[model samples]
Target chain A: MDVFEAVAEPTRRHLISLLAERERTAGELVDSLPALTQPAVSRHLRILRETGLVEVRPDGQRRIYALKPDGLQRIDDWITPYRRFWRDHLAALEQHLENQ
Target chain B: MDVFEAVAEPTRRHLISLLAERERTAGELVDSLPALTQPAVSRHLRILRETGLVEVRPDGQRRIYALKPDGLQRIDDWITPYRRFWRDHLAALEQHLENQ
Candidate 1:
């Protein structure tokens, strides 16, 4: 799956959210998502790995998962131009709030 | 459909990419994506509209489409925490480049 497909899944997105804070073991990730089973989390991790969003490193008995910033460049590139839209609107909103 | 389902389709993402530059008419968007037929483009636009990603205003004979920044807030909220990953790596990369 591509970056788009990888992020489209809410479960995978939640996993990314967890990793955003710090690297965690596969067991730790499974504990965070109470609704999902270990196999389901494993599948989600596989999809994330295939999409290049997450990297795994062996740490003796456990594999640690970490966020790969380069993997997110596709999204950053896609959203870069569009940021002006928010900046412009936010500036206006700030001015309006200041006036009020 | 929800935001996830709406953005998962590649045609819809392509339509969004076009609108990122500037607003366009239905005909204009159709012309831009030569690979897809007008009906397909219309369908994609419908999905974008339902997801609140794009808004439409009538210009007499034609409807003009524009990007809605609020629609993107969902993504922004989702990505906010993860942005630090890029910022940290980017700062390190910049330092590395400076040293070279």
Candidate 2:
């Protein structure tokens, strides 16, 4: 799956948000989401890694995961052009709000 | 599917890029993509509509499609936090370029 599809799920998005703060071991990541089974978290991490949104490295017996900022460039590039539309609308809204 | 999944396909992304410029009828969209069968294009359009990335309205005997800027807010919001990481990196790269 592409990065877009990888991030479509809320669980994966949450994992990304967590990794944004700092790198974490697979165990630490699983622990962070106590509600999910260890396997479930691992599955999400695998998808993220496969999509290049997250990078995994060996840390002795454990695997470390961190957000790969480069992987997100595709998404950022895709959204860049469309930003003008929203930014203009948002700017107008802000102006209207200030007047009110 | 969510907006991310909806836009994962390249064809869907193309349709979005097209609609970003102007509203088009379904037929016009299909005409723009001569390589795809009419049914295939329709399928993509349906997915876009279902995901709320594109909105359709009755235009005489045809339906008009346009990019729904509000629908993209979820994606924009998701990327907002990550922008700092990329922005910082990009700014540093720009400074380095100027120095060189």
- Candidate DockQ scores, in order: 0.54, 0.54
**What local lDDT does model 1 show for residue B38?**
93
TM-score of predicted structure 2: 0.83
lDDT of 2 at B27: 97
Query: What digit string (tens of lDDT, one per residue) describes model 2 on residues B32-100?
Result: 999999999999999999998998999899999999877777788888888787777789989999999
Runs of candidate 2 exceeding 4 Å displacement:
A91-100, B90-100
In candidate 1, what are the lDDT values of residues A1-93, reduced to their tens digit? 788788888888888888888899999999999999999999999899989999999899988999899777777676667777878888999
Cand. 2 Cα-lDDT = 0.89
Per-prediction fnat values? 0.39, 0.50
Give me the runs in candidate 1 sitting further than 4 Å from their true place.
A93-100, B93-100
Top TM-score model: 1
Q: Interface root-mean-square deviation for each candidate?
A: 1.9, 1.7
| Candidate achieving the largest lDDT | 2
Q: In model 1 chain A, where is the ten-residue run with the lowest total lDDT?
A: A72-81
Clashes of 2: 0
